[model samples]
Target: MIKRKKIYIEALRILAIFLVLFQHVPAFDYYLQDTSHVMGHLFFTLIAKINVPLFLMISGSLLLNREEGYREIFRKRMIKIILAILIFNFLVYLAENQFVFDLQDYCLGVFENGIDRSYWYLYSYLGFLVMMPLLHRIAQKMTKNDFILILFIHFVFSTIEPLLQWFVPTYLGQSFEFTWAFRIPFSTIKEIFYPLMGYYIDRKIHIESIHKKTLAGLGCLSLLGILISMFFTIWIGNQEGFSDEYLELFDYVSALSAFILIKSFFVHYEAVIPAWISQKIVLLGSVTYGVYLWDPFFRKLFFDGFDQFMIPWVGGFFSSVLWCICSFLVCGILVQFLKRIPKVKSLF
Candidate 1:
């Protein structure tokens, strides 16, 4: 029997993709340099930074619950992503290189650096797919406390330590080597935490048991945390030449909280959403991968042609929102068209 798509999940996917598009807006650099709108840029960019975390959480929520074997995973999941990467990368390469076909240059670009840096997620996701079976097994066996413990460990090594290293004065710190001191090497496991956290929340948490007031308070705090982090990021960037270490760390924390809050809100009120709207959300969500692959092309096309005209009047933030909306719509339509072609459909 075929399963029904959860509207809340689709909503999350839509939000994630829009955030991805918004974050990639070319005007960010312009805003960053503009004294008048730097804070606004920082605020929006911080929110946009949640895109990857949200996507990973969605993946975790959907994939961890399944019991697919290695063969099934490779055939059903990995192959498609691999093909998408190759095909889209080549398309991007051709576009960037003016349709020049150089096998040697193309191969070097593919191996040394991606032809399109936006496709980094596809390669990372391919790695995630390779490890999904093992991850699923661990996730299935994990108790709530085990999940929490892993999250805590990741938080310490990944978030807390990094922040401390950045803020602490170098003169006051001493390096001491201990043979028995062991660390989980969170640098490698950082990306793994989001999916695991997603599975934990989706499968283990009973949202109904929690009070609405409590959830609201947590959500408010999460928003505040995101804002505070953005402010600090701006301040530090101005003072210390703009390293994203602190902001990126806080992003993981904030994104997790935001994901939970958004998921809870959708779960509680999803039924009230009009059926027509939900259908559109699902349709848009379904085409997100394709849209994502094609977004940069449209983004450049639109931004280059229209940004100068719009920015001076409506300002940077609003102009970016407008561009993002247009880019998403165009990319969505393009993806739908491509999906109809038998030879190209598999890439999406």
Candidate 2:
């Protein structure tokens, strides 16, 4: 028998995914152009950084059950993820043009640029999923030394490689061409690190002893990570000013650290956060994958002809936020409806 702490896990998952939705819209950064405006921008950025790491860590923690073999795992996750990606892609395509099945174009486009936008991550994760069996087999023999060695390889191949390319001489550039760049997204250092962390955290770290210190640790690191990330953006921004457009290297690292610490804190304090709240988190988290797949519809709404009528920051921000929230709701609705349809339900 297994313990199902559904609410606690789900709550965080929902928070994580919706926050990702918030990131794409004007909801967070439109207001944070300068220090004088509001702290909401920095808050959003901080959350954005931590969010994916939390999601990935949770995946590592939750999916490490060895009873499921490669075939079974692929059937359960890989196919579902792919189908979900296609569903959203189709929705977005339809919403964007009021027409469907532009097979020639879609095929050529996918073959060429590789699915566009966030879907790229899905493709990358597909690669990761394929490697899971090998990873699992190696996991049995894993040690702290092995873990640190993996981290060092990640640093050399993922983090340091990029830095060296930007600064170093001729030969330092070749590592960039390696295929892991396409598959792992910064070497999946966190993915590799977190599952191993989970194994130890579950087996070694005592819940009670960690409670107070975990809270303090998460708080401090979250603050520190945000400050360092913001400093990178601000220090660079003032010289040229920060654009809320996209993320950078330091942003990813700080965000990764902040989220890891935060998740650990949450696990440490699981008993304190009321039952209702945990249920909400679990519900949202479960539905989040569907929402992710359905996001392109909302994305279409953002780029719709509404642009002609309102291009102002306030208008754009509100409209984008509305679309994103509505998209989450719509995705949830569609998923529920899809479950009732026997044919559609079978696909996932």
Index of the highest-TM-score prediction: 1
TM-score of 1: 0.89
lDDT of candidate 2 over 238-315, digit per residue (tens): 666666433334444444444445455566667677766666566566677767766756676654654444556446
* Lowest summed lDDT window (length 10), candidate 2: 1-10
| TM-scores of all candidate predictions against the true structure | 0.89, 0.74
Give the CA lDDT, 0 to 100, for residue 164 in model 2: 55
* Candidate 1 lDDT, 1-348, residue by residue in tens: 111337667777888899888877765444456646777666666777779888887888789889899999999899998777777777777777767788888777777647777778888888788778877887788797887788777767756676566556545576533233657632236457778888878788876576888787877766776776766677777887654555565666667777667667767776776778777877888888888888765554456567789988997667878987887888889888988999877777
Q: Cα lDDT of all candidates, in order?
A: 0.74, 0.58
Error of 2 at 219 (Å): 2.3
- Model 1 deviation from the true structure expressed as Cα RMSD, one decimal place: 3.1
For candidate 1, list the clashing residue pairs, or say none: none
